[model samples]
Target: MSFDYDLFVIGGGSGGVRAARISAGYGAKVALAEESRMGGTCVIRGCVPKKLMVFASAAPAEAAQARGFGWEDATAGNFSWDAFKVRLDAELNRLEAAYTKGLEVAGVNIFHQRAHIVGPHEVELADGMRVSAKHILIAAGGRPYLPGIPGDDLGMISDDLFLLDRLPGRVLVVGGGFIACEFSTILNGLGVDTTLVYRGDKVLRGFDNDLRELLTMQLADSGIHVRLKQNPARLDKQGDQTRVTFEDGKVEDFDAVIFATGRAPYTKGLGLENAGVTLAPNGAVAVDEWSQTNIPSIFAVGDVTDRVNLTPVAIREGHAFADTIFGNKPHNLDHGLVASAVYTRPHEVASIGMTEDEAIQRGGVEIYDTRFRPMKSLFAGSDARVMMKLIVDEATRKVLGCQIFGPEAGELIQLVAIPITMGATKEDFDLTVAVHPTLAEELVTMRQPSRRHEAPAPA
Candidate 1:
């Protein structure tokens, strides 16, 4: 049976756009609908804009460090969020336009409206237009989740950070995850009196414990107040300020309260149930390795599937889905061993592979680690430490994980991910010659295990 289109994709995000474009490239007629901006969260709200802020936030500290290298000071007392916001908004507009243009160039019909699954092979747009296709793809991404507390709406989400007209004099940031830590680091660097309150004992809960411990210290050292085992019980707007009352009965006032708490799949009101698509309890669309849903005519990818939730991962998933279904080159995007980075200035972090906890659970593990004041920081008379760690399988001598928490950690980890993904052994890392007088050389130069755990004799 002929249809209006070959594929109907409900999101215009990184995944949806790539899928729609590639499917059309393979001569499949495609239509895509996006209720919001074409670039979705990454280009519009999450990574792109946030990373720019990370760069902007680093200026003050880097300038101070330069003076220590015998350069004269031409210091600015404060960062101008107003001036930066104008440029940031313009850049985002250019990106959104680029994404839309690319989709058009690829021959995908674009719909600037909301869409939801109405049938196994049909989608209904916000304008009440029902379109039928041979297959449907849901690439709708996730939304920032705000915990329900009294007057929580008075607080802001990470998306709101990019839109702020001015940076707050002081801000209270909530949550313990990467998003939380990242913004906290940015705000602190930007000279906002930033306080980070996490309900857990340490920040970055799922990362290697060494990273968690070092990052927590780094945040505190960089002048961000790290408050653990605490949570905001309520938030109240007091004129231009927010008065936060914590679970422990501590009250604090700040010009703003930002919640980088977490995000939930943006599947609400998408009418997935109408298509008989399975959904996880948190509302993420359930799909197989090939991204197909229970109903073969429908599929989901990207953050909507709640798998790996990174922009690169989403793009690969989209490419894999289109190639498998349309181009006849069947392959699944491997979710394992994907590298990620937190662009926190002065102490950025990048990591790949298992945490120490996971490695220990698998079998015997060996951990090699180092922490020291880097040459630059030492030259500047700052005692800030950089931490690098390797988690290795004791029995096989294979590197299980590589984590670095310091300057350029993100860039270094990207290169390290290549070797680790190729199943590089600890011996390989040890045998490699160290690059002289560089922070990254520590990764290759560590001679002995800091600790080792033998498999518990099969329990």
Candidate 2:
């Protein structure tokens, strides 16, 4: 079929950009459209800016802890939100330019307008321009979701955090997910009176139970009022304060209420139905392992697919999709054993593979768990302890998973994922020499199993 381009990509996110660039590199005529910024969520409002905030928020605590290292002059003074915001905005602008430059270098036509499917092979841009292609890619990503409730508009979402002109004096963070927990900690460290309210019994619902419990204690110790089993019935603005009425009728007021409840796929207004593309019940675009939609010429990736919604995973999926269809290197991404890290105060949480609950559900398994105060914390007289756990298959002794909650947990997990992905066994880990004077050595030093469980026989 004759078309304007070989490929037309909607949403210049990590996934779409990677797909477009790689496809262009393969000598395919490509064009991409993004109504918003070029870098999408991660670069503009998500991981990039969020991590910078994490670093900024840690300054106070780190400065306070310096006293233990003989630096008597160290003190956490006033933080200027205005100053940080200026630098953050500049960094975002630089990053967006980089994304645009990369796309241009790859020979992909850039359109700074929203694009939606008008037909299986046709997309209409916001400027009333229609473009036809042999294939279409959707990588629109996701956005923070706010629940429908009375006066809910009074509350803010994660995106609002980056746009705040000034930091709130008192903040209420809603949700039990990583976003809620991370922001709660960040705000608390930044000297805001932070309160975290989650309807669930515990936060980080799907993570290892031990890690969740440890984090709960750490958060409370760090001065974040953790309220579990509570949800807001409504939110109302009252004279510069947000009044939150809980489902149980308890009322609390805060300078701001941020909802990190969850994110929904960004598939709206994309005209997927008109193009014969299927969408999941959660509004994510339905696609195969290779990211192909029901309509042969249409495909989706990244948060829009709701499959392992991490930036790196999305980029890999995009690269894989391009290689398979355009580069002539057919392959599919194995979504298993994807590692992730959550940046929280005092420590971080990271994991790869299955959780303890998941391992038990699979079959017989053995678990190794340990908790201790690291040398640095011990010297500082801090009560915070590090946690390390390994979930191993009883039958094969293969390490099915690993979880760590401590300083540099994220860095450790990245290296640990290499062996786990290669199917390393518990014995192999035990045989490895430990790196002394380090927290991660505990991973290799633990020789005894803390517990073992046998799965129930088939019913």
Candidate 3:
């Protein structure tokens, strides 16, 4: 069928950009439309900027650690939000420019306007222009969801936190998810009085219970007021600050209230129905493993499809889709077994494969878990302890899951994911030589299962 391009990608996010670039590389004419920024959520708001803030916010703790290491002159003074924001904005601009350059170099036409499906193979931009394509890819990412409460607009989401002109003296962070935990840590580290309120019993509700409990303690130890089982009923703007009324009928005032409750798929008003596309109950675009929507001519990837919502996963899905459709390589990403990390204060949480609970529920599994204060943190006079857990299948001796909570945990889990994803066994891990004096060595040296559960008998 004759069309405007071989592939028309809506939303210039990491996923969309990758699909567009790869499809163009395969000699398919491509065009991409982005209503906002070219780099999408990761580069512009979510990961890149958040990580930068994580680094910036850690200055105080790092300075204290330096002092503990005998650098008496090291001091953690007041953080200058204005100064950091200037540099941050510049870096984002550079990244946005790079995204634009890459798309241009890849021969993908770029449209700096909103777009939606008007037909199976047609897209209508905000300017009333309609373009048709042989195939369409939707990579429009997710949007941060705010609680449907009074004066919710006055509360800031994660994106708004990054754009703040100045850090508040006292801040109230909402939700039990990683976003709420991480930002509470960031604000506390930046010398703000931070209080975290989550309706759940603990933060990071879906992670391993051991990690969750320890992390909650670690967060409290780091000086964040952890208010569990509590949620803000409403937010009211009181002069320059915000007054939050809790469900318990308690009231508190804060310089700002930030909502990190959760994010929803960014498929709103895309007119998917016009294209006969299907959407999940949660509003995510319904797609197959190959990212193909109900309409054969249309496909969706990234958070829009709500599979694995991580940036790397989205990129993989996008690449897989482009390869399958344009490069004669029919393949799809294995949505399962992808590794993830949460950047929280005092420590990081990383995991791959099943949790202990999942392993217990599935077949049967043995668990090897250890906790100790690492040498580096020990020398720095920090009380934070490191934990490493291995969930193994006793029958096959294969490691079912690995979770690490400590220094360089993110890096450690990345490497651990390699072996776990390769179907490495507990014996295989034990066979490897331990890196002396390293916390990760525990992965190889644990000879005993702290607990074991045999598989349930067949009915």
Candidate 4:
């Protein structure tokens, strides 16, 4: 007997759209529901818009450096915040329309409404319509979390920052995660007096310690007041300015306060409890290796389940889930060997797998690492630098992890991740010929183990 639908996906974010569209292509009847825009967090608020802002903020600095490259006079003039807002609005509208069109082109039924799980095989939409499917996938993504301070109403979350009516002259950024660091860098680069306040010692807490240190230095050098080991206690507004008081009695005044602290699973009103689906204590829909929920017919992916919150990771997980469940090709998502990048000024940080500290804790590990200034920076009189590290298991000789900090770190780490996930060894990198005049070549061309293990002979 044919079922109503092979798959029904909720949340039209990256994961939901990809899974719904791909599964439909495999002859599976698929229906996708999204209460918001199609592009999800990345396109609408998180990554794409944020990166565009970062690019806009860096243009002045780039133009200034272009003078050294032979231009007698290279000056970036005053930029209007309103002009940027207009451009961003037009671009975002186009992106959302494109995502919708893509899904429509894939022959997937798109429903623009809130979806709720009335049962394992049944879903109800906000418009009083219901649909039934063999499998229900939840990919609601995540929303920025605000601190529970006395005056949180006076501040904004990461989402609100993108749709602001006006740019603030002075902004206070709270949190220690990638979001906080990136927004702080972008705001400061755009000539805003940005003060980053974090409860941790550094901005990116779980990233490689070396990269964290280097990024901290770069942010500080760029004029961001890095306030560590501090927590926001309260906020007071006085005629358009917000004064943030820290738990330690430190006070900072700004035109706006941004809480980039963290995000929770976006399952607020999906009625998961009514459907007997298990959720983690933190409110994420619990899932197994195959993205299956406690209820066999229900599944979840992306930030909703509290796994790696990267856009690419979510896209991969969705594809794997669709392949495993509908495409008849069983697949399991391996979290290791996944690469990530932080968009910060002067230096970009990228990494796959464990850090040196983590490798040491695992025991019987060897780390080969290197640091140097980029060649292009030398002629430009720029102090920007690049660093790379390789972590390997001593006994097995299997490459366990890799991390890089510098220009194009994100671009360089992708190549390493493929071989690393394939279980390539340190000797494999040693034998590979270096790509001359490229920053990535430094990853494979290190002369010796900077910290652990022995040097290998060249190929």
Per-candidate alpha-carbon RMSD to the true structure: 1.4, 1.1, 1.0, 3.4
Model 1: per-residue Cα lDDT over 138-220, one tens digit each: 99999998899999999999999888877888999998888998899888888899999999998888888878888888788
**For model 4, where is the 10-residue window of minimal lDDT?**
450-459
Predicted candidate 4, C-alpha RMSD:
3.4
**For model 4, what is the alpha-carbon lDDT of residue 368?**
84
* TM-score for each candidate, following the candidate numbering: 0.97, 0.98, 0.98, 0.95
lDDT (Cα) of model 4: 0.87
Q: Name the TM-score of candidate 3.
A: 0.98
Report clash pairs, candidate 3: none
Question: Of the candidates numbered 3 and 4, which has the greater lDDT value?
Answer: 3
Q: What overall lDDT goes with each candidate model?
A: 0.90, 0.92, 0.91, 0.87
Which clashing pairs does model 1 show? none
Error of 2 at 413 (Å): 0.9
Q: Write the per-residue lDDT of candidate 3 for residues 1-459, one digit (tens) a residue.
A: 689889999999899999999999999999999999999999999889988989998988899899989999998787888888999999999999999999999999999999998998899999999999999999999999989988888899998987787789999999878788889888998899999998888789878888898888888999999999988888888888899999999999999999998999998899999988999999999998889988999999999998888999989998998899999999999978989888986799989988987877876899999999889879989878999999998788888899889976888999999999999999899999999988889999999989877788999
Which parts of model 1 are misplaced by more than 4 Å? none
| Local error of candidate 3 at residue 156 (angstroms) | 0.9
Question: What TM-score does model 4 achieve against the real structure?
Answer: 0.95
Give me the displacement of residue 118 in model 1, in angstroms. Answer: 0.8
